[model samples]
Target chain A: MLYREAGQFKTSYAADQAIFPLAQDRIGMAIILAVAFIAIPAVANEYWLQTIMIPFLILSLAALGLNVLTGYAGQLSLGTGGFMAVGAFAAYKFATAFPEMNIIVVFLISGLISAAVGIVFGVPSLRIKGFYLAVATLAAQFFLLWLLVKYPWFYNYDPSGVISAPPIDIFGFAIDTAVSKYMLTLIIVSVLALATKNLVRSHIGRGWMAIRDMDIAAEIIGFRPLTTKLSAFAVSSFLVGVAGAMYAFLYLGSVEAAAFDITTSFNILFMVIVGGLGSVLGSFIGAAFILTLPIFLDNFPRMLGFEISVETVTHLQFMIFGALIIFFLIVEPHGLARLWTITKEKLRAWPFPY
Target chain B: MAFFLEVLTGGLLTGVLYSLVALGFVLIFKASGVFNFAQGAMVLFAALFFVGFIDLGVPVVLSAILTIAVMILLAYLIERLVLSHLVNQEAISLFMATIGISYFLDGFGQTIWGSDIRRLDIGLPQDAFVFGASVLGDDIFVNELDVVAAVVAGALVAVLAVFFSKTKIGRALRAVADDHQAAMSVGIPLRSIWMIVWAVAGIVGLVAGIMWGAKLGVQFSLSLVALKALPVLILGGFTSVPGAIVGGLMIGAGEKLAEVYLGPVIGGAIEDWFAYMLAMIFLLFRPQGLFGEKIIERI
Candidate 1:
């Protein structure tokens, strides 16, 4: 009854084409945003803000980036971690070189750097398709990591090859606290995520979806394959790069090139796939699921009063997480977004067998 | 000159092991069209099981046989639990599923066999074979393990070639690879063929695991070697057995030469990404791989 949109009426094309066309969806989204912006910030402790919310947001952004290409554009990339490394390293360089510049500017420049790298790697998509293309991306993943590690210049010649984000200030407001960092991440993520929604709704997004569905058909229909594919790569990598900067600057603070390894790439791809490929909200859901699962797993045994070693917990987490990935794929390859929609449908038809 | 020979020989031998792993990938991909990302995990699992069995006091030969049996059981389990349920899905979906399988196998292998890097001394010598100094005024050398690995890889390729051409099941697998619907139409049980293919791939992974594990120690990196096989697969065609062989040798040799000659200039450690970079550049000119057929897309 609560989810029913039967009485909802749209008088104009703009109204009908609105992101949340249904009144119920609009209300639901408003409530979620309210809680996220107000309730959580007011109540969530430092640990939750720094450890959980910040990571969830950053990873969701990364997942959104991957979703753009792999989910929306049908380009299966394994170079996400490498691109992220580019972003992180670029940001590090920017922040150190121009210490007086705005942190926001640093993030944007880094993202652009990553976008350039992404396009270079994406050039292979013109020549290669499917599995062959996927393998080509692996070169990006490895080569970038090697570049970051081999060159000490990226890390500001730190003897340990590890770099830390310098203190960032916006208009004399030092964003060093967990709450401030969380707020910064939230603002960046929301603005970019909104832009993503708009982008996906535009003809460009349709072009990507067309390519995803059938590149040959998309090409026949007057879309340039190189431009469409590279644009997807550029936009996706830009978001991922920003997320990488946030991950290093806001979340981890101190990090090394090793932080963004092949595992990180696989993890982001999993988030995109498990979150739902083409759904915007699915990115957040998938990120939250993958990121939080490990923490929950680590704490569950102890909370139940059983003393378990950290090693055992980690091992169990991998096994369970792996099984869960398989389970989700088999049960609903469309991911949690599809499940959410299904539940909404059920809610609308409540108290009926159908 | 002798030093050049040593580096070349080393690369060739290392390339053989890479080919063995790539062979596992080619077999499954050829038969089922699933890009089994779990191939690396299978290598790790097989090595772990073999070593775990031996750790429990089983003889090496018996442990090897039992490990093979376990891999066969794994093949059956995967086909039943994962593959059968996922039939007729998109190639990307199938690929993602295999990645799921990879994660599971990685965790399961380590959980059962312990995650510590373990040494397997199957009495293989570790010393290098040296050519006498009188011939070239310097000793030419080859690692014994590399020599053994190369010989084993050669034999495995020969045996697989014979099996694919001569065996009935192999012919059926080839049929399935050619066209799934046509094979099914002819009453060839697709499930059985998949199982056989996976089992054979599992065995190939096992051999790769043993040789690599012996060289690097049975550790997580053994799984990463599987990633190295991807460039080899690209260089050699993913479906061509001979392609994997030559691709592996070229990659192994190319990376080594680059490392020895280009490493100092680049500050070293080019081995990690050299093969992938080569494959990426090569793909621009030849996307179907050196041997893979050029696919013509139809709307």
Candidate 2:
């Protein structure tokens, strides 16, 4: 009865087109936001805030970026790690060059740089489609990492070639503590996530979805494939880049180019696929599922009163992760988000048969 | 001049091995339109199993036979469990599934055989054969293993070519690759065709593993050869056997030449990304690849 939207009525076009038209959805979203913004930070421990939630938010943002291109636009990329590396190094360079600038500006600038690089790599998508295009993206993956590693200029000629994020200060508040970092990440991700939700509902998102569903048909309907595909790449990489920057500045603190390798690309792709391809919420769900899985594997054995060796745990983790990917794909190829929507639909129709 | 010849010869031999790995990819892709990302993992698993069997004191011939049997069984299991459910799924889904298979194989292979690198001795001669000593006033060295590999690859290709052209099962495979629905309507079994194709791919992976394992030791990095072979696959064309051969040679030769000639300007590690860069550049101009059939899109 509480979840029902029986009396909700659209009084105007604006109301009908509102992102969350239902009173129940708006209330649910507000509760979720309040919990994330207030309750979690207040009660959660340092380890939980730093390791679990921060990475989840940052990776969710990256997966969101990827979801735009792969899920919404129907373009496949294995170069996410490379694009993320661009973001991290670009942010690092921007911060060091202009130490007096605000950290948020630095993140945005880095995201723009990532967008430019993404467009260059994305040019091949027009000519190639599917697995072939996917392989082309691997060029970006290898070449970008190689460039960052080889050129010391990107890392300011650091002897070890590893760049550490300078302390982020926004408006005289240093983002050094776990709570501060978590809060910053939370704010950035929420804003981006909200913006993405809006953007995907707009014309640009429709164009991407059009291309994804059928490029030829979309083109016949007057949508330019080139611009649509390029914009998807640019926007997707921009978000991925911001996440990469946050991953370095907020999460890892210090990272080498090798950290963003092919495996990292695959990990992000897994989050996108397992989360749910086209859905915005799927990104967060996927990231949460992937990030928490290891923690679950680690603690579950301990909780069950059996001590496991690290190596055995590692082996089992891979096997289980692999099996889960296949199982999820077979069971629900649309991803975890589909299941969530299905449940929501069932709940909405509870106590009455359609 | 002698140095150039040595590098060229060495690259050509390396290309032969890359082609062997790419052959597995082509076979699977041709038959099922799946990219088969797990080809690398299969190479590693096969090598590890062979080495494990050897360590268990099995004779070389028996170990080889047993590994082939295991690979055939793997093909069956993959078809029944993974590919069957995914018959009409999109290419991307199949690609992701293969990646899943890769992960499972990586973990399972290491768990069963231990993660340590083991020396694989197939009694192949490792001595360098000196050439052009009298003609060019300098010696050019060629590893005997490379020469043996080239000969073996040539023989294998010849056998495959004949088998594909002359045999009933091979004809069935080509028919399946042509059109699954048409072939099914004409009384061909799609499942068995997939099994046969996967089995052939498995045997190719075995040969690649043995050669690479003997050269580089049977270890985790052996799987990386699969990734390295990807550029070769793109350069050659996914469906063409001749494409794999020529593409592999070009990449191997081009990478080696670039490392030696162009490495100085870039600080000397161009070998890692050279093939991919070449593939990327080539793809922009001819997306279909050197030998891949032109891609015709439909509404």
The best candidate by DockQ is 1
lDDT of each structure? Answer: 0.91, 0.91
Model 2, span A1-354: residue lDDT tens: 567678888889999999998888899999999999999999999999998999999999999999999999999999999999999999999999999999999999999999999999999999888877888899999999989998889888889766677888999998899999999999999999999999999999999999999999999998999999999999999999999999999999985787789998999899999899999999999999988987898888889998877877777777778888888888888889999899888888886848
Weakest lDDT window of 10 consecutive positions for candidate 2 chain A: A1-10
RMSD values, in order shown: 1.6, 1.4
Among all windows of 10 consecutive residues in model 1 chain B, the one with the lowest summed lDDT is B129-138
Candidate 2 structure quality by residue, lDDT tens digits, B124-237: 878899866644777899989988888888888898888888999888888988998999999999999999889889888999999999999999898888999999999999
Candidate 1 wrongly placed segments (more than 4 Å): A348-354, B131-137
| Error in Å for residue B134 of model 1 | 7.3
lDDT of 2 at A109: 96
On residues A101-168, what C-alpha lDDT tens digit does candidate 1 reach at each position? 99999999999999999999999998888899889999999999999888788887799767777989
- Once superposed on the true structure, which residue ranges of model 2 sit more than 4 Å away at CA? A1-5, B132-135
